[model samples]
Target: MSPNGSPDVQAITRLVEEVKKCVEALALPDRRAALSSLRSAISVLEDPEEAAFAQIFQSPIYNFAIRMGVELGIFRKLLERNGTPVSAADLAAECAAEELLLVRIMRVLTAIGYAGESGEREYVASQLSKAMVVPYLEAFAVHSSEHSARAAIRAPEYFKLHGYKTPVDSRNCPLQFALETDLHFFDWIHRHPEKAKRFNVCMTGNKLRRREWFEWYPVAECLLKPFERRNRNDSAFLVDMGGGKGRHLEALMKSFPSTESHLVLQDLPGTISSLENLSSGIRPMSHDIFSPQPVVGALAYYTHFVLHDFTDERCRVFLRAVASAMTPGYSRLLLNEAVIPERGCPPVFATGDITMMLVLAGIQRSKRHWVELVESAGLRVVDVWVSPDDGDMEGVIEAEVAS
Candidate 1:
């Protein structure tokens, strides 16, 4: 009940309590049912505007909370302590952060259901928070926060001051701008070792999620099967252009162990240098695909989630480079990306298109758009294969260099 003693408030409170009970009951046996119930409760409690606002505002708030967690070394500390609860003051002391700041961050986390506050200053990690603590997932948190902060900092000046309508209206987008000013993302991070380390940690953390996708889709295996049939000396190479840190390549190797292949990881000079200590079967090369692709005579050139990062013109340049670097016959170009469907599709990919607009001036393209883009690059779309478990927007598109 409200302190104002409103009957409507009392009724709503009772309804919310009832919904919670229903959620708990449904959750015991089936999580999907519980989630549906929770969604229903939200719909009942919140009007369309309120619900939309809650959904959108959560990204920035959650990013801020995650950034604070990273800065305070909360995940490392929690992992070291075996996921035990800790007081805010004690945590602050351990991380050398201010107690009040830690509490403030934890309070936000509690509100968002990432953590739970038991007493005045005591806090415990929740299941959701534990997921964030896992190293690979934690990288995603770090990336989200870093990208959000960079975008926010530039938003006011580039958008408001310049009278730009939206982020896309700005020249080069936030990421491209950052890259231009900072000598590209990998270059800047390389010069600043600390930032580079953080970036690596964040990227590696986020890789954990995509690693699961490989198990179901097995794009790596599918692409390598033909290569494995060839002679040992006539091995194929999965050239991951713009392959930062070879995370995808590592996953590919793990999936197709018998495929006698080499992983050619091409990126900026700085990123390539960082791979000096990388294990065997992975050859890190420093070459800008925008200039020219150096490697040739490969069985397959795999570009996973890299094409959508550029405009059609730029993507053509990239694909042209790939074509130039491949042998005429037997060589294939495999693009493992989301092939957006036109109608009756899920909202996540559509929403993802907006993020691309803000971050890199990239987009989630439909199959038609992909066909046009690849053809412009002198490549023909041979076939599109959807993993049994994958949704409409994501699939492997097999392509070949145009004659």
Candidate 2:
């Protein structure tokens, strides 16, 4: 130990003071920015075991603790009271969990910085905690804990039985092995309505103020009719294949309300039927991507975070369908899926890839993979729009039908 207890301790003290100053100076730091800085700082300052291995080992405990907070309405209660400190007894009464047990759980919550210990026996939600209570997050946590975790926990068993060679079909993957059923991921979700809602929420989260292809892509330039011919627009400009909830189309309609080009949204019949207060701006159609493109000759066929749910062969089926219907010289295909870097991926993407591997044999493909896949489907790459600063994961890939 150095003179001041320990060098690491002193370093932490200095870092904490510096962080305090930085945060204090800012009127309001972005949530993601704050999280990024905190995570980077912790990685360097904290013990490797505690930061890495220990946390990995104890991750389930933390995940479940967060789940319990969501399920028990603890965060809702605290938020309702507007961050006012409340005793364990009051929370216990509100949630129906025993006070003593709640106290133990609250200790875990506070330890994780989700809940702040306002007084000796009271608690309040932190800003991060409030953000975590979104319906999207609740659904995600439950999905990970109950549905995804079941398959994830049994990933080793699947590996042991089937070997590590992947590129397998999603229907016959680890999820099937874990559940002892051969249904596809969507079919399984259909059987469980509640879990389907959760799945929907998670998908909705993707379209809700999150990073998307349109952020860097020229949406207006591609979709909008040239101002000179505004009165004579005929065909659909874009079709969002398997686009859930029609959120993307609706958002775009708002952005280009004056443009006369038709916007189309295509998905399953059930998805189309469930959409509420759907904007009149988008032409809704019940069509599967695997089937022939029903809305033909679209200037752009957009697919975001959709292709990863299937095997390579299934992706080929979807792409071939689009290629067959697209006008050779006019139509363009825009892929918003991840083109994972060759070097290394962020931990979140790594974990996501592994989880997808367990359930769907899904891959975040590299640029070469994207090129090969598109060419195999009779399409040629036009441009790949990437923005590393905004974490676009190799961004959007624009392609056109092969001549």
Candidate 3:
């Protein structure tokens, strides 16, 4: 063992080396399976009881340190100072923070690999510290500390009040109870535009999405090739229902520029406005999903990560609205979502499922949930094709107008 090595250090080193080796085997047939298995094995080997115990003891302090780091602008300040190391005294003077508290927080950050210790009492921005300035992530961290985490603290009481059942209404979730608000999630977002802006764009970044719908969705067979031969009229070839900023649509248009598919994007007005530089070929329409869909009888109506934000009752409304505009036997509705397992969902995605439940009163459904949803909406599930379980969130549910 190294002179300064502890069990935690040894564990982390093994974890990193194991990850590197597993990643190197990606060219093999079971790359996904290999990665999945590696992840499972790592979960046990990486977090031995000793490390878990240490984590439990250290987590509260870690949270406090990060919260203070975000609030006091330690990350931003350190980044602005460039590669130069800053002493605690200098940082406290600049940020007007208490010197002792600032030092403690900085120590925590450095210990956690967020920053680098330079000299005896000075610190320099590490790569992770520099990355912290990404606006959305910082915003999310702030939002978590300010909001959802607080709601989580009240979980036992909120659950008891709600009969220990899953909340199905945004206005009645644990967050609503914690904040003592009657407003639904979207209404609350509207009232707080600053938070809404950060929250909405968070998913658009590469961080949230593992793969694109076109990677799994039968875009070429379902929409593009049909569009290539179909008559081009006022109606768009594909209506990207609730597509935020048309990222997928943009990729489609770029991928098949010559295809006759005219792209249209329908989303809430506020979300649409952020697409000021929306590509020329795509049409942007401010339309609510609950209302009747204005674009009718398109080749396909595509939705990405949208339905996961609504309860089944609300989802039915959305589905029926889109269904109303579909031409029987001709139009298709493609839903891009995460098909969480009935049980033992991966930890990364389970967090998302929980967030949807608490924040939007929506759900991350399994295959059973998808079938019920489609059948309830007066549609038939033609196919539920999933990508190679890159173990990334994968679901591309295709439905057509009921016969």
Top TM-score hit: 2
> Model 3, residue 370: what's the lDDT?
96
- State every prediction's TM-score relative to the real structure: 0.71, 0.87, 0.84
lDDT by residue for model 1 over 240-356, one digit each (tens)?
Answer: 777777877777777666542477778888778867556577777888878777777777777777777666777787888888877765688877778877895556677677657
Q: Rank candidates, lDDT, best first.
A: 3, 2, 1
Per residue, candidate 2 scores C-alpha lDDT tens digits across 1-403 of 4776666667668877887777755533254477677888778867987778766787888888888898898888888888678999998999999999899888888988878899876998887588778889877888887767888888778877887678387787878888899898779888999888788788667645545456567766764543224343677777888887887777766766753347888899988988888778787889988998887777778987788777778889989999988887778898888777777566767777777877777877778888888888888998887744444364678898988
Model 3 ranges with Cα > 4 A deviation: 1-57, 206-209, 259-261, 270-275
Residue 109 local lDDT, model 1: 80
lDDT (Cα, tens digit) per residue for candidate 3, span 99-215:
998888888899998889988779899988876777666776667765667777787798998789988777888888888898887788779988777666554453353656676
In model 1, the runs with Cα more than 4 Å from the true position are 1-41, 52-62, 73-102, 136-143, 152-171, 175-183, 211-232, 235-238, 244-258, 261-286, 291-297, 325-329, 341-352, 390-394
Order of all candidates by TM-score, from best down to worst? 2, 3, 1
lDDT of each: 0.68, 0.78, 0.80
Instruction: Please identify which of the two predictions, 1 or 2, would achieve the higher TM-score against the true structure.
Output: 2
Backbone clash total for model 2 is 0
User: What range of 10 consecutive residues in model 2 has the weakest lDDT sum?
Assistant: 223-232
